[model samples]
Target chain A: MTRMNERLKKIIIIVVGLLMILLMAISFGGRERITAVESQLGSFIAPVQRFFSQIGNFMDEKTEPIINVLNYKSLNESLAKENEMLKAQVVSLTMAQKDFEELNDLKQSLHYVERSDQDNYISCSVIAKDIGNWFNMFTIDAGTEQGVTKNSTVINGNGLVGLVYEVGSNWSKVISIIDHKSSVGFEMLRVTDDYDGILSGTTNYELVGELYDTQANVHVNDYIVTSGLGMYPKGILIGQIYELVDDRDLFLKQIKVKPAVDFKKLNKVMVIPYDEYEEEITTYLP
Target chain B: MNKIFVFLMAIANFILMSTLFQQFRVYGVLANLCIVFSIIFAILFSEQHGYIFAIVSGLLQDTFLGKVLFVNTIIYIILIYVTVRIEKIMFKGNDLTPIFLISMATIAYHLIFFVFMFLLQSTIPIHQLLMHVIIEVILNSVIGLFIYRVVFKNVFGYKLGDYNA
Candidate 1:
């Protein structure tokens, strides 16, 4: 009987080992298939994701009042400072508006002039950021129900934040330009010449744009703007050149650009609707 | 009563670790409180109960965040088994052994996770990877020590003589 029990144990061990090996092999072979299934499953569970996100946001909102009560003095000081900044900005904008009217006459002589019609912007508020070693994403409160769609451009008052990757009923995920997979056609604002580069995120919360080719003539502090590609509108600010490299041994001259939008301070955003810009660009392109 | 308490604690710890404590990432690593809970549950409960709790916790984790199904459950079962085996030899309830055991268990958990990700062709940098493991282990150990005191002294009312039986 003892020998029979030992044989049973051996058989069990061998079976388990074989099963483990088979499982590992299947996992290796079907990774893409598994990921596709998972993503599709995620889409199906978008309502649950939205529910959890809403709960988290509600918790944060409830705590905010308590935090405000505890830090009332500091909050007041911050509000005062913000009010002063807004007043100064209002004065400056008034002056700029006058200057823009004067320059409207000179704009006729320019070769490629594009005017911004601001009627198509849908406002949104950022709810949460998915920042970890594995994933870098941000969630905004607007989604397909609110006229947001995949590939829609998200911008703040400063500049481009990211593009909408996934849209649920009431929430959307923005794949920030800082992510490794993000690429954009950018050009120097001073020259209006086109250059292509990829935007990548560093360990630190910084977006670095690496421009390819040595003859791009990009210098430190040069304003980087989008290339007016059919996707992104022209003249939207990308970032400012942070680092410039010019070594003979290197294959491409690279420049690190610091994004204009402060993601940490992100609270509100504007989503550029498809119809208005798409109509304008399609007329211009083909 | 004990089974219910363990199950509740496991779920609570999982939720807090994934949602609340996730915001406190130190050098891109957050403490794995689930590891601490698994170790404590293994030490406090029967071996069969410990294994059951590990599977439950792992399944919950898998449902929420796991990319590879069953991997976390298998690792957690191994962890419970190892901890239970060690408890048999050095079963002192009051010494620093529990802290040391939890620290080692967490480290092993992280190492296994790293190897799994590496096998899956993840591009995590070596420095960041090492930092993640060390930070999580240290944080879990510190938190586990305080938690151990509370669970044994207050929650279970476990005495020194309880282990001998």
Candidate 2:
């Protein structure tokens, strides 16, 4: 009787293992919306994560002062130099703003329709990050309760952070742009709109891209922004190009990008809810 | 009573890994506390207890991450089973036993995870994946040894040389 039970237990384990593998296959392929069970689980854990995250913040706050004290001299030197440069830029920007306002008034008088970009955003703080080192996903405090939805654009002061991949009642999971699974459509800032490419994240948490046309006038240090395609909206800064890999064999212009957002220190983010009706589909150039 | 306490510890470790331990990342790799705890449980207790702890920890991690359920759970269950089998063959009452077991478990965990991810069409390069695995192994070994000693002395109420088998 004991031998029979042992055999039965082994069979059950194998059967269950196969079923889990099958479920994982479906979940990965379907990439379906979050299920009710997952949503409930997320809601339950969100507050606990928030509490722990607060404790972490407190610890960092306490330790930061000591670390800053050690490097205060060098920090002060750099800040003074940067402050002077920023003061000069502010003066030039003020003059440019006056000219831009004058041109805007003239355009309005000519009966040009005013274009408004994104205006709705829900702010949230990062509560937890993925336990695995493989993916660059994190949990935030806001969720569908706060108008956050799946595929919503998440950004911070620096630049584009990522998109909300899963949403719960009181929390949401965001997949950052540095995740290997992320891909964004981008165009060079201030360059021809026709010159666009797809930037993707690698396992090393770095961004790499390939332009659609090899002949496109692209170079290092050129800024890249969302082309208003796919999940991300237009004009959100993605990153700047740092390296342009020349591949004559495949006739592809591969390039490397440095993302603007410092993902390691992500604290707060703004979520622009995904809306199909409000999406403005217009040609960016010509 | 011990089972319940172990289950709660699993939850605590999972929560801490996702929140507090993230701040302690070295070389862009965070030590997976869940894996470390799972291995420790398997080494210190019976195989059956290890299996139960694995399921709880793995489920908590998978649910919190909001990914496909049971992926981590399955990997962890297999890990527990392997650890138990290896324990029977090797001398486990040594100081370096936990570190050795943890290094092996971390490698296996990543290998299985990478295979599943590759099947899902992930685009991680081979060289980068190997580098990540190497760093994680080292990190897990160091962190795992620290945790194992604490669990040994506090939870099990065992002295340094009191461990048998």
Ten-residue segment with the worst summed lDDT in candidate 2 chain A? A277-286
| TM-score versus the correct structure, for each prediction | 0.61, 0.89
What is the Å distance of residue A181 in model 2 from its true position?
Answer: 1.9
User: Which runs of model 2 end up more than 4 angstroms from their true locations?
Assistant: A29-32, A68-99, A191-194, A281-286, B153-165
Give the CAPRI class of candidate 2. medium
TM-score of chain B of each: 0.83, 0.86
lDDT of 2 by residue, A74-157 (tens): 989999998998899799889989999999899989999877656677988999988887888888989778998778889998
Model 1: DockQ score: 0.22
Candidate 1 segments exceeding 4 Å error: A1-132, A138-191, A223-238, A245-249, A261-286, B1-29, B46-98, B105-121, B155-165
Score candidate 1 by TM-score against the native: 0.61
Note the DockQ of each predicted structure: 0.22, 0.64
